[model samples]
Target: MQMMSVSALNEKIKSLLEATFLHIRVEGEVASVTYHSSGHLYFSVKDDRSTLRCVMWRSNVSRMRFRLEKGEHIVIDGSIGVYTPRGEYQLIAVQIEPYGRGALALAFEQLKKKLEAKGYFDATRKKPLPPYPRRIALVTAAGGAALQDMLKVARRRWPLVELLVLDVRVQGEGAAEEIARGIAYADTLGADLIVTGRGGGSVEDLWAFNEEAVADAIYAAQTPVVSAVGHEVDTLISDFVADLRAPTPSAAIEMILPDANELLRTIDELGEQMGRRVAQILHQKEERLRREAEAIRGASVLRRLVTLEESFARIGRDLREVIRYRLSQFEGRISPLERQMTESVDLRLRRSGEELRSLSEALRRNDPTLRSKEGWAEVLSEGRRRALESIKVGERFELSDGRVKVRAQCLEKRPLK
Candidate 1:
């Protein structure tokens, strides 16, 4: 101490404190807590008797399940050490826990029960998963294992679906606010479905899901949501409020998809059933047609036609006989009349000829030859008489002359004597 420099003295003190407190547990009320931008956590631990400065490395801070805040009663496990450069003594806390029910935890539990009583977890409120979801929104840490698991499962089961990852913090201050904003953003992007959760962790690690803001956001989402937080045994408020809940991210995908083989088999079966029905209908129609044909063949249509033909033939024969009888009667009547007419005409002609002959004979009798014969006979008788008279007179005249001359001779002789 008399000859030691400041740096050497500080180093010696640091070595003494490190050796004195190897591992210890301290119970105190947290105060003046601060988180550096460097990712380290600093706080003061105070008991009734004393207070100590505590520092947790960024590595351990990253692993913490809960947020560190001032005025919270806590118990921590760490080692007391001296910082040689700063020449200060401090506690290095490796692990820490709240002494009672944490304020954040109390709030989470109260809100969860209230929402549950309002039927937020009711099966009736849950929506059905789409048969084929084309777009899926994811609300979780971009770098976390949860997002990776979801991608793997979605791609394996339904590769055709589009994935939209909305990266946001899953824990710590303002983490719940970021998650709610992510859910709203996904809804605006027109995601068909949403899968919101994180990898497995303790109750405090998954406290973001228990947030009132996160639950309200899930309930308000227009798209259907699938909650996959922690392992199967772990349940968060988000799981109850979402449209569907799965034990893990992989299970969530399986819940939403249909088996391709099963669907194809169903289609084939329906086709076969339809084919059989159509064939049965056709067969029935064919049988009906056959029956109709047989009925037509058994009917008496041909017999009716033959009867009609016979009746027509009988009428024709009767008509021909009647016409022949009428023609024969007409001919007989006309023949007698024609014969009488011929006889009458011949008789009239003969009578006229006889009358003409008689008239000609009368005319001949009164001709000039008869008159001339009568006249010639009269003339011959008259001429013969006249010739006889003339001869007698001549003889008498000759006698008278001779007598007169003899008488005259007697007288004259007497006178002369």
Candidate 2:
């Protein structure tokens, strides 16, 4: 027999137990469970016959998806080893899973229950999207197909909305953390809406959106957040916590953005309706005026008013005809003068337009030609200038540009001023 110190005996036992149970699976109900402040997990698993002490270091605990609870049946995979200091044998667990379900599934149920109790999925807490969001931020993987899908949908729908794409990992390790950070950062931007999503994939691939970190960030965002992950059938934790849930990345854009073509069509329809309404109003007003006028005419005391109105109407018709005839004659006369003055045709037209406006006002006062200071003109007959002394009384001459042509009999011969 070999004699050994207590420390050496415990060391030998540790080496023997570790070598014998290098890889084993133990299934039992959890008994005593403690999550140490040092980040290690200490627990015991027991059956009816025996109880086994178990310990998982912080490194392994960090990788676990679900929390362990006393009385829950679980299966731990690890090797048995001796704690040399305490001279006790224990199971140093490397991995743990629920007895009959996948760890991820159990984790999903647990987190969903926990967050649901916290009112994370309350519909009243979710924000309504702006009817016409001017700026939208997309939190997604920059190079992923999901980003491309969203971009295409947004461009096709509302191209005027400015899109800010924030790149982040959407899958694999550290993806949830990146997604959480991306959401929080996107909220700082003054985006009217924020969309975070990825393309459809397997459960493992889409697990980042199921993470609690992502859910927490989505809940805390100031901007309206839309979770668009996986297919219509696939729901995630982030979707529940987001302000809105879209079935897919492309669907998110379709849901939030107003279609440009649809808006244009609506505007055109409204304009047509407005024009029709205005025409209807004018027709109603005109009919009312005619009825009122006829009623006034029926009264003998107002009969003179009807006659005066008719006279004014006739005068207005005659004045309009005279103006038209004068304008036609001036078109030929003004072209030559405009060329002689070295003025642009547009400049002449603009000045003539102003003169026409002034002429309309002068017609109200029975004045036609009011000479401007710039140019002078003389009456012409058969392409020759006619002096006032050479014309007879009651002989009519055409006026050009609303200016009066004088007849010879109107004035005696006088020296020029």
Candidate 3:
């Protein structure tokens, strides 16, 4: 009405709306929600008769505990603002919360529903915790009470286990991502088990455990994971997805580790029982030996032994008699055989002597030395017997007749006609 330019008129409306609606709150059912890649949230709040457009910039949206989903009742705390280019007024949300519930609680229920549908909480898929873990990857805040409690319990229960403290933020903004990354890294550490948790706190303080990222990490762990968030009454999505759930950090340590003192007591009992059993066995053996010795000392046993010896002596006498009788029978049977053998041996010796004498006579008759006894001799030249004609003239020769020898020089050759 006052001849204002288009930009100035729009600016005036924006100024009025922003001033009047500053630090206001509105509750409605959400619709047309869009989570932009730029991290801004674009959505609408609608009622039966009216609708309002809303936007939460990335900075504020990043701080929100839960997502803005369509048809959800939400309360946004912000003021009206104008997009001057479009001259559109919208609610710029600075803070948002679920209409009737805490944002973290709502987020917890939402994530629980989503992951449950995805089978994150199925008992069949849960890994069985180790009875005695050799190494444990403790995923928690480094200096928090949770870590101290777990360590104390572990030391008291099982000092043998190797605890690898994987420090991570257990609460506050971005804590869920840190926890998830910690779990993933712990899986690579060859730990027999993983225990992740923090000390008790408010729902917001423990909200990281309720995050979907933490739940997914727990669900995907190869190592058996034990969720021990907050106190006994508090539960998180991690508890549902983990292989096991403990009421508290200290309880997780106790749940997974054997009690060293109890084990020592058991060992002592076993050792005593073993010693008693050994003593009992030795006593049994000694009693058996004593009974056997008593039996041996009995008069009846001595009598049996003596009777056995007498029987053995009688058997020996009978055996000797049988041996003597067998020898006599063998001697009787061998007498004729001995006589015939002696007679045959004497006849053979006599025949052999007669043949020997006959052979001697024949050898004497055919003896070449006998010719020498009848006046024949062998002539030799140069140590060999040769014809007189073969002897070279002037060569020396020898002749022997029986017991006589003659040496002569061959001076002439002579031939017999």
Best by TM-score: 2
Better of 1 and 3 by lDDT: 3
**Per-residue lDDT of candidate 1, residues 182-272 (tens digit):** 9988989987898888888877788889887899999888889999888999888898899988898767777886555666788999999
Q: Summarize candidate 3's per-residue lDDT along 1-417 as a digit string, tens digits.
A: 479888998999999988998999999998789999999999999999999999999999988877778989999999999988889999999999998888878877778888889999899998887788999999999989889999899999999999999999998879999999999999999999999999999988998898888988888889999999999999888898999999999998988999999999999999999999999999999999999998777758777889999999999999999999999999998989999999999999999999999999998866657867776777887778877677887988998764677999988887878
TM-score of 3: 0.64
Least accurate stretch of 10 residues (summed lDDT) in model 2?
367-376
Against the reference, the lDDT scores of all candidates come to 0.80, 0.90, 0.91
All candidates: TM-score: 0.46, 0.68, 0.64
**Candidate 3: misplaced stretches above 4 Å?**
1-8, 84-86, 272-417
Candidate 1 structure lDDT:
0.80
- Once fitted onto the true fold, the runs of candidate 2 whose alpha carbons sit more than 4 angstroms away are 1-16, 84-87, 302-417
Give the per-residue lDDT digits (tens) of candidate 2, residues 57-142.
Answer: 99999999889989989999999988799999989999999999999888899999999999999999989999999999999999
| lDDT of model number 3 | 0.91
* TM-score, ranked from best to worst: 2, 3, 1
Q: Pick the candidate with the highest lDDT.
A: 3
The candidate, 2 or 3, that scores higher on lDDT is 3
